[model samples]
Target: MRQTRLRPPRLKAGDGVTVVSPSWRGGEVFPQRAARGAADLTARTGLRVSISSVKPGLCPESRAGRAEEFNRAVQDPATRAILWMIGGLTASELLPLIDYEAFGARPKVLCGYSDATVLHHALYARTGATTFYGPALLSQFAENGGTPELTMDSFAELTMRGWTGRFPTASEVIEEFVDWADDSRPRRAVPALPRKALRPGLAQGPLLAGCVPSALQLLGTPWLPDYRGHVLAFEFTDDNGYGPGQAARDLWQLRHAGLLDGVEGLVLGRPRGWSDAQREQLERIVLDVCHGTAFPIVTEFEFGHTDPVLTLPTGVPVELDNTTLTLLEPSVR
Candidate 1:
């Protein structure tokens, strides 16, 4: 049964936001970069920002600590939103510790991507809270020079103010990473390739967007959402262990689980750190797995680990026809 989707109140200037690390402690590992991100976030949105009280550790106890920070942020009336410090592998570890009841009672804007996809699906399943699948602190705002205008503008339009209509794509994307140790160096970007139409058709349905591997990890768990009648959007991350092989297996896993049975459309983000050949292989793998599916399939739409991404609201209605994507409803009140 699908829960009643809740659209959190839109943010305004001076809205309070709490940054939490439910996964990797990017803030703890790179304090200078974190500081830069925090400053940039405030400057960009005029939202007063504060960091949650959590430390870096991979111990069992650390997960509990991270969950507590997330809970407090959700429960606090002063916090209009919760921002992720960064995405990592351990977000699933905090799933058991999250206070879904508190989150349901006090639905606040939640923004993140990559590993945070698990949390998004969990929230959508348990609370029906619409969360923004967008940039993380260190990853976007803390970019060496500054946050990309396209990324910040989308974040503001979708999460802070209400927005509806066609989504914009970034003409250039930051694919090259500048080491955190060299915080002064700006990231180099390459021109974005045109989006491809893997399967041609048209459809509009509620958007279900997330990281590929993180979302697959939720399969068979209560956190995995009901994808029937959804326009599923996913992106491959730059995680060292993931590649075209894993991508095939993951999509097949979804197909086997029947999660793709009623999907209305499919949108894929350009994979981070992927060569042209690898991307072509990925497209072939997708078509093979979703073979005979009548829905439209588009690839290389911007989102996920890449810089200058759109802030997509999970659970909102979206139209996808070939390479074009449009938001059909407001993501926030």
Candidate 2:
């Protein structure tokens, strides 16, 4: 019972974008980062940016207010795309008030991740609107002076124009995370190990994933987009009172629900904010799950909450092999 895929229109230069806060308004908390992000989106990406929620205050005040702003942006003809500000644990609370019909009637590029993952799943399942698992306003694009080249490049490809190519190689990863304080603390760098093929083989299907912990919250909910026949990807981010055991359990939940019955491949994003012991334990859990299948598994991708991450188009077709993943179709156009 898969819905026909919905792809948003590719953006062009000067197209107006509305930065909506479907969750916490990170911009409100960090005004400097917020201003820098808005200005950078125009200066760096060449897109005309406007505001929906980045105001003179933190905390959106009410769920109804956030939903109203989001729906208004969707219905606005001038706004071609809507970018999320930042993800929070309470995104699901806004789901009830979202105008899904309006979203279905006019699909536009909706980009975000982490807590924004909830909105992506709900929109795709309820209205079949394709969404981007990419950067947000105050978090990714507004990083200090600017974001990394890798982040900017991939984001342009996925959001501004449709891309049909391999994921651009990430030379290194920023593993050292500094708590976001005033005046900006930067993400520290580490050498990126070459991606390893886990249980190598080949598989082709629509791509669907998010930070597994965020994704797990949608389990058993109608808003959880169907994962069947999709190349499933998962990663660890914003540890919500969980660890490797919880990660493994979430994977088992999918298997238990028979959601993975039609899946043929898997990808694991690089472990950010995790130790060697934790990563090892997590890998053991993954290997145990894949013991019987050569399902074209690959790990250590630069996505999730890690810095210099790739902007992935959810619900798009992709081909996976031992060494690489290639998009079979354009994500935006």
Candidate 3:
């Protein structure tokens, strides 16, 4: 989207990671779980995690305290990477407090998803720094039975070694509804059901995008990076309970804003709650907008709002083969 600027190498065993609460300060209200999540990262990664002071009593409103905590985490020399403690609705408020110039001076991995997308875009746009659209501490690490090994492996490849490759087509797709709190759910072989292609041609570019609404929220903001020559990758959760039409409207807005006008490719992460009819409607909308465009449009990637979510590195080079709808890239570093 902008001039390519890579961050420092991903963390290795013994490297330090910091956990900060940029969104909701659940660590103060829900201290036990938050503490457990920080501890869990050490156990899972065999790396030390430093907890930021701002995590406790993080205010959702625009407060200097929360911003200072996030800035401290970013500016810390010992911190090789920073992970969000949780994602909620109000993370956008902290955008102003982030000194992108300072972040640019010392680029490091900033990782999270959903609400954290705001920070990801802001950092990427202002500094050309690569950010990650991956699982957070509380949702990914602290859950019972610990983090999924696949998820951990993806994190390592993307963050530590920069391993990027086409995600292996899941052998068995699970269409059943499973509870997030259930420890057994992630272990199951939930193969992703394939959807028909919108356009039949391959395209390649840097991968970009996160939760749909979060991306849309930055449409007119200066923080929204240029999408040209980037493959748009997105998915949505049911948290907002948006209907099919509403979802279509968001995509339509992207088209109207010229965000989708000249993208090299498009990867539609599986929309979590769309019915079969709604899915078909989405397919039509995508096809309509991209009718004369010569880029590929692949759907049903097994990332975002899906179990066994594959962590993706934003701003990494990617190749999409429309015939197979397969995504290929070197391991993210």
Candidate 4:
């Protein structure tokens, strides 16, 4: 791991935010909706936003454009935080082009998920700067009506107010989904389902991890951060559900790479839209990897690729209590 510098504080009302596409660039297709989301973000929090140059590009997947835009946005003195428009499979391509030293000197909240995980790990490993695993501009902000209150609240706690506290484990389970694209669905607050604890015990360490495959893709690369003494977290989208054999293979790769050797604990989010069999298989794989290890493991905490997801801060101290199965930490400075 690289030596980390002091991180920039969370954003506040009237502060400036920059939206950039460091991986995939589909912002141009929905410029109007994207603009509305940005406006809503500003209005909801009283923060100002500047759309990065990459937002209006022809091909956001192009490595040259992404690297140039990322460098410019992070270097801009006025930009308090950077938001990714979408997570692309090609974010790793920008790694060679990224100036990690520059980011280390001026650390800010770099946020995104999925493919953005590559950048998050790269930034933290190369520069020792903290980042966030949360919703993206289009994923969370660009809803037809507005951002979900739960997402908004989590974002505020993690990014602005810095209210890092133990995430509330659901006492009673309730599950529901709103098609933000559908105007007919009433937007209402729904209770989060109770979090299931895969193993029993409390564990504490710096929070790390992201989309499973994305993190796995970086295993052999020099950019992958050293997860020693860290709490590893992972979640997967509906598109690529890992089976028993697949999950075992992935964990084997991490083990072979020495990634999980010193990991203090594991926090597995409920895989969204995964079958019961797949979930069971994943749970077994997790157990096998941690077998004989002294670290506590907690599974099925609600975060990542799911509604009502909790936002986690990378590189922050976190405590997981097995009795409650909650990941606790301060959201910000």
Which residue ranges in model 3 land beyond 4 Å of their true spot? 1-3, 55-61, 171-191, 323-333
Pick the winner on lDDT between candidates 2 and 4. Answer: 2
lDDT of all predictions: 0.87, 0.80, 0.73, 0.73
State which candidate has the highest TM-score: 1
Give the per-residue lDDT digits (tens) of candidate 3, residues 119-224. Answer: 8888888888788888787766655556666666777677787665565544443345545444343444544577446676777777786888888888778888
Over 4 Å off in model 1, which ranges? 1-4, 55-61
TM-score per prediction, in order, is 0.96, 0.92, 0.87, 0.87
In order, how many clashes per candidate?
Answer: 0, 0, 12, 3
Alpha-carbon error at 208 in model 2, in Å?
Answer: 0.9
Expressed as tens digits, the lDDT of each residue in 89-133 for candidate 4 is 788888899878878888887778888889899888877777889
RMSD in Å for all candidates = 1.9, 2.4, 3.1, 3.1
What TM-score would you give candidate 2 relative to the actual structure?
A: 0.92
Best by lDDT: 1
Native-referenced Cα lDDT, model 2: 0.80
Better of 1 and 4 by TM-score: 1
Badly placed stretches (over 4 Å) of model 4 are: 1-5, 55-60, 170-192, 240-245, 323-332
